[model samples]
Every structure is written in C-alpha cells, then in structure tokens.
Target: MDEIPIFIAILSFIVMCIGEILAYYSISLKYRYEFEAISFGFIFGVATLILIPKSFFEGFEIFVVFGMIVVYLIEKYLAYCPLSRKYCIECDNLEEVIKIKFIYPISFFIHTFIDGLIIAVSYISNIGLPLYFAILLHKLPAGFVLMSPLKGVYKNPLYPGVIVSFGTVLGTVIGLITLKNISPKILLAFSGGIFLGAFLMLVPHIYEHKKEKSFLYLLIGYILVMVITLIQ
Candidate 1:
C-alpha cells in the first residue's frame, strides 16, 4: 500500500470529523443546510462527470457498470431502514425516530469501511493518488450529509463523527493490510462501478429533496473537480 493514499485517507477522515463537529454545534442551521444542499449538488456533478470517467479509463471495464448497478440496487434497501424516516414523510414521534437514527450511522460505518477497501485496492494498483484525492474530496460533502440530518436527532457532535471516524480507520487498516491480496480487475471495476452508482443515486435524490436546485454550486463542484484533476 502506498503511504500517500493512507496519509490521504487519514487526512480525509480528520477533515470529515472536524466538519461534522462544526455542523453539529453550529447555530446557523438554515445557512448550513442551504450550503449543504449546494455542496451536495456540486459533489454529485463532479463525481459523475470527472471522477467516474477518470476511474473507468484508468482500467475499470464496461462490465463493471453492471456490477455497480447490482450493488447499488441491493444497497438501496438500507435507505428504507427505520432511520430513514428522517427523510421520509410518514415518520411520527421523536421517540420512534430517535430509536432508528442509530441505524444510519451503523450502516455508514460499513459504507466507509468499503470506501477504505476501495482506496486500498486502487492505490495498490498504482492508480491511487488521483483517485485518492477524488475520494478524499468526496468525503467532505458526505460528512456534511451524514451529520446535518442527525443534528436534530442527536445532541452530541462527537456521536456521529466518532462512529464515522472509527469506521474509516477500520477500513483503512483493512485496505492497507490486504492491499496486494485483492484482484485489481475485479476490485477496481466493481469498486469503480460502485462509486459511479453512488454518484448517479445522489443526483436524483438531491433534485427531489431540493425543489429549487442550486446550479451554481453544482457548477462549482464540477469546476473544482476539474481543477483537482488538472493540478494532479
């Protein structure tokens, strides 16, 4: 495993933790969410247009798209978990809602672990640095997305951040330790597909949640991703 990717992952994890903490404690709730929505669009657009294609040409194949679709469909089930009531219309009672919110963080733990594994596999193949930075930037919006919703449901800033950070660390360890063991073709293709699927899934969801979409933020995200690619 390359030290660069590992270092990047650790840094990304810390960035996310700090962002979550700020979001959890911040009093400007409205401004924060508005910013988050725009950030979401920007990240989604960038990932779809730049990161996904770059990843594919790096070696992920056409068949990997199918694998990604399949995995995404399966993962969608997690969205319906009781915790998802935060996004649902029919949810009632703070007590019941709070009971299930924990489920989201738990699932996030697993998701971040997979993210680490994907990073590990990619870096080992020598396609790691650019993808590593892409993935790292990807987490900033993700951290906001994860904590923003939970702000109302939980009191502690550390709660979600700690769980997410723990998950990231665990995944990084697994990825670093098992770097060479994973098959590059399958891991890269499949993981690449997964990343693409994630981007696709978020686009529609963002539009649905935000009736008035922020094209400016979306464009900024696109430009930022391009700049990151160009600089690298």
Candidate 2:
C-alpha cells in the first residue's frame, strides 16, 4: 500500500520545508526569483570517466533526456485541461482515451524497467527518503507551474504523469551504478545538485503561493533531511 512510509515521508517533507523559516521568508521577499538556465555546465570533474568511454556518458545523457520527456508526459496528467477535446470530461471518455492513446505495452515495459531501476537504486541507497520528501513537497505546486506548457501541448494530464514516473525508474538505474564509484566529493556534490534541482522546480510555486509560504515548513525540511541522514 505504501501507506506507512509514504505518509511519514510526505510528512517529513512538510516538516522540513516548514522548518526553514529564513529560506521560506527569503523566497517571499524581493530578492526571490530565478530565470531558467538554458544550458548544462559540462562540468569536468576530478576523476571523470577515464576508463568509461565518452560514448557511454553520451548514451546515458541521451537516455536522461528521454526520461525527461517521459516526465513531461506524466506531468500532463496532474494538470486539469478543460480545453482538451481528447476525451469526454464526464463520460467514460477518459478510460477509452487512455486505452487507445497508450503506446505499445512493450515500449512502456522497457521504459518502466529503466525507470524502476533508477528508483530502486536511489531508494536502496536511502537518498530516496529525502528524494521522496523533496518530490512530495514540490509536486502539487510544481504540477500547477507546469500547466503552462501542458496547456500549450493540449493533451490529457494523466498520460504525461505515467510517462514521468516511468522515467524516474530509468534515472534510478543510472544514478545507482555510477554513484558508487564516483569520488566522495563528487557524490556529495551530486546529491547537493539533486537537491538544488529539486528546489529549482519548487521556485515557481513558492513565488505563486507567496502568502502560503511556511517558514516552519522550510525548517522542518532541513531537520528532517538531517534526521534521515542519521538513520541511514
């Protein structure tokens, strides 16, 4: 059921975000906005893929982009698109559309397998608790923020959400395999990067919902992450 940890984990995220009063307040204030960086910093780290070919990294990078597309797909589901003429809003249209629009089962199986691998590795490594918390804290608002693009595409919301979830499985696989061998400094940096990206996704919501920003929630986010680290 995922009833136990799912809730606790979600609660932890709430607490963590609530706890950071300064950051929460900071987000609401004047100096609190960001523009999307239209670039990837090809960061040449210490101990890069000397043995691992450049092609492998290139392949994985392509896969990661593919996964993002899946995420975009799943995100469509989380948003309500009244203008969507794909299915009847009230009738059995949704079920019917879901049946026909769904791509090949075999394609999804391969996609899901990769996505599952990513989630499994990340969860097994215990970054999952924090990642889960991070995701829950941001998902609802993030969904709304994403509505802009989803509207542009004009598709059913549920379809994209499924795609995104499957993408996570793929990410978990790649993350797990490479993370272990990477330098400690790199791992720390990578984890921090993950947290940063999570926050980047959180920003638009924080801005849009400034009145609802909770300092305590931010504080709780920090404390809970620390606690999770201790447990791990």
Candidate 3:
C-alpha cells in the first residue's frame, strides 16, 4: 500500500499515452502494412515469450487457453453481428470496424490493467525498477497498436488512450489496496490468452497490404520484443 507503486503506475500511464499519441498520427493508408505487421509481431512476441510462458510456469495455462478461446469466439460473433452494425451499415471495412469498436478495446483494457497490477506488485516486492523498464519498453508499442486501427471508429482519437489509461489506473489502485489477498496468476493467464487471440486476429491485416514489407516488419517487431525480454 505504499505510495511508490502508485507513482510508478502513474508514470507508466503517461508513457503509454505518449505512444497512443504517436500512433494516432501514424494511422495512414501508406503505413498500414508496416504498422499492422509490427503490431502482429509485437503481440505474438508478448504472447509466446512473456505471457504464455509465465502462465505455463505458474500452472495457469488452461486459463490462457480459455481466454484465447473467448476472444476468438467473441471475434467470430462480432464479425457477423457487429456492435456498431447499425451505425456502420454502409461501411465496407467491417473487420477493422469490429476490431476498433470491440476487440481491441476489450483486449487492451484487460492487458493494460494486468500490466499496472504487475508493476504495482513488483514495486511492492522491491524489484520494480527492472520490471518497470520492461513494462515501459512495451508500453509505446502497446499504445501504438491500440491506437492504430481506431481512426474511423472514434471521432476523438484520444478515446482509446483514455480507456487504456483508466484500466491501468484502476489496476494500480486495486493492486495497492489488496496486494496481499489477491492472486494475479489467473488474471495474468487469462490476459495472456486474450493477447494470443488478439495476435491471431491481426494476422490477416498484416498481410492485407504490403505482403513483403509486412513480413519484414513483423520479424523486426518480434526481434525487438525478444531483445526486450533478453535485457530483462
């Protein structure tokens, strides 16, 4: 319940917002392929290298799988019956619309909330600096990915950033207040599953435009994550 973790959480939220701002400006047709490719790679790396492994080590793999399946099913359902179908009837880009409106927001909220919780816990354990940097390394990309596809969905480009920031803040508050009584493994595993599902969903978009360059960017993104993990 110390104030240090709370302060670190606030800093993390600020870093994430910076990334979101950068992404908002980067959402253009010219860079769509590269953006998505990097996003896919980033998400993939996070799932395989970080989330999934942690879940397995903690013996919470089933929850990871369950989270993935839940995201997958929800995505499938949204494909046909989109949450904003009435408003977007004339829109041809149904997939992006669905993602921006539903999937990404849900996934980002859960994932970032977990990120905040982890930060709080790590700080409370007196091992927060390294973990904070690790989390910081990905926050930019995380924010970028969350904001990249949100152009047409929201009139105000800052909504996604606000949603993610709120989640992080909420998680931090909860972590600070109930650090002793709560077990985050299950939530961690489930969030990992959601990331995995979200990564799968990005596959098609990555290849939709610049096939060759997209693959290259994907590799770069994955390598960036790998490097981050190594440093940690």
Candidate 4:
C-alpha cells in the first residue's frame, strides 16, 4: 500500500517520457505546431476548473480560494521577472523559438515538480483513484506539448524529452521526501490553484499567436480534454 503511490508516480513519469519522445519524432519540424500547444492549454484549464473546485467543495475552501487568488495574481500580473521576460518573447521566428526552448525546460521543470509533489501527496494520503488518474492523464499530454516548440528548434529530438522528464523525476524526488510533512488536502488545493492560474494565463497567449489564426486548435484542445473526461 505504501509503495503504490511511488509506483504510480514513476509510471506517470515514464508515460510523460514516452509522450515527449513520440511527439518529438512524429511532429514535423518544418512548422510550428500550434494545435498541440493549445491542446495542452485546454487540458490544463479544464482540469484546473474541475479539480480545484472539487477540492474547494470537499472542505479545503480556504486553501483552494487562497491558492486560486494568489496564483491568479502571480501568474497574471507578477510573472514578469528577467527570466520570464526572456522566455515570453513572441515566438515569431526561429531565434524566438530557440529562446523559448531554453525557457521551456525551466517552466516545465516547475510544472512537473508540482505534478510530482501532488501525486506523491495524493497517493500518500490515500486520495481517491479518480483524482489519481486525473493527474496521470495530464502528464501524458504535457510531454507532447513540452516538445512541440523544441521540435522546430533542435535536431537531436531527444533533448526536450529528457529535459522535461528530468523535471518530473526531480519533482517526484522532492515530493517523496517532503510531502509527508504537509497536509495533503492543503497541498493539493494549492497546487490546483497554481495549475489553474498558470494555464489560464496561457490560454489567451495561445489564441493570440495561433498559427491558423483561428480557434481550431483551442477547440481541439477542448475536445481532447473532453475525451480525458470521458475516460474518467
């Protein structure tokens, strides 16, 4: 029983790795693939809406709301440090994509760290299977999305996958070591808020620079999220 969460965490990491590799190879490097990127945004937005609210209703109201407000503000208004600025330049050219590639690993590292922390906390607390699977499902798409931009910039193809997967592993290690000390519900709620804020911030940016100049990718993202929902 104690080891189950660890096992699942490792499995999710593997899934993420596989997703990244497959995406790196399958996606064309000749063009910027906006669809996969927006799909990632959609998955994150819908999951946040569902999971955070669920945590809120289940009695983590204060934590959930606090998390939501804090993350929303931080992501929306305060996410502009030197590093962030370097990462957020418009992805308009190959040079921009290369800059973004350097930025991608940093953002993905933080994101996956949270993923590992939550996965460890949830399973350690014996949280329900439904939520467990929900978390797992997100990692699958994350790999694809994390690799999308890099596909155009790097020739090795495996570099982005390894970088993002390393983030997951790093997060998992930290979570396994520290998560036992935190209240699972509180931790989960806070993470959910962060996820919501982060993804919410990306939605508009994705639409603004959409390759097709349409919401087709965003719609596809919604459909993908819906499919994950149905799987649940």
RMSD of each predicted structure: 4.5, 12.9, 5.8, 5.6
Clashing residue pairs in candidate 1 are none
**Model 1 Cα displacement at 76 (Å)?**
2.1
Give the range where candidate 2 is weakest over 10 consecutive residues by summed lDDT.
38-47
> Candidates 2 and 3: which is better by TM-score?
3
- Give per-residue CA lDDT, model 3, range 64-133, as digits (tens): 8898897677555543224322112223555655555776577568667866776665555444454455
Collision pairs in model 3: none
Q: Report, for every candidate in turn, its global Cα lDDT versus the true structure.
A: 0.59, 0.34, 0.64, 0.59
The candidate that wins on TM-score is: 1
lDDT for residue 193 in candidate 3, whole number 0-100: 81
**What is the overall TM-score of model 1 with all chains considered together?**
0.71
Candidate 4, residues 169-225: lDDT per residue as tens digits?
Answer: 566667778778877667767666655655556566555556454367656655665
lDDT by residue for model 1 over 1-232, one digit each (tens)? 3676677768878877766766566633344334544444444544455445545544466746775675465456555334332233223433345433675666566667777776776677666555565556656555655675676667674676667766666677787787677665566666656666665655554445454755555556567656666775
Tens digits of lDDT, candidate 2, 1-232: 2243334433432332332222323233222211111000100110021111211432344433443454344323432223221111222323333332342222333433332342333444443554444434433322222222333343554345344333433444455555566543333333333333323333333334332543334444455555555575
Considering TM-score, where higher is better, how would the candidates rank from best to worst? 1, 4, 3, 2
Q: After superposition, how far is residue 37 of candidate 2 from its true place, in Å?
A: 22
Off by over 4 Å in 2: 1-128, 140-152, 197-205, 227-232
Q: What lDDT does candidate 4 reach at residue 204?
A: 60
Order of models, best lDDT first: 3, 4, 1, 2
Off by over 4 Å in 4: 27-62, 69-98, 202-232
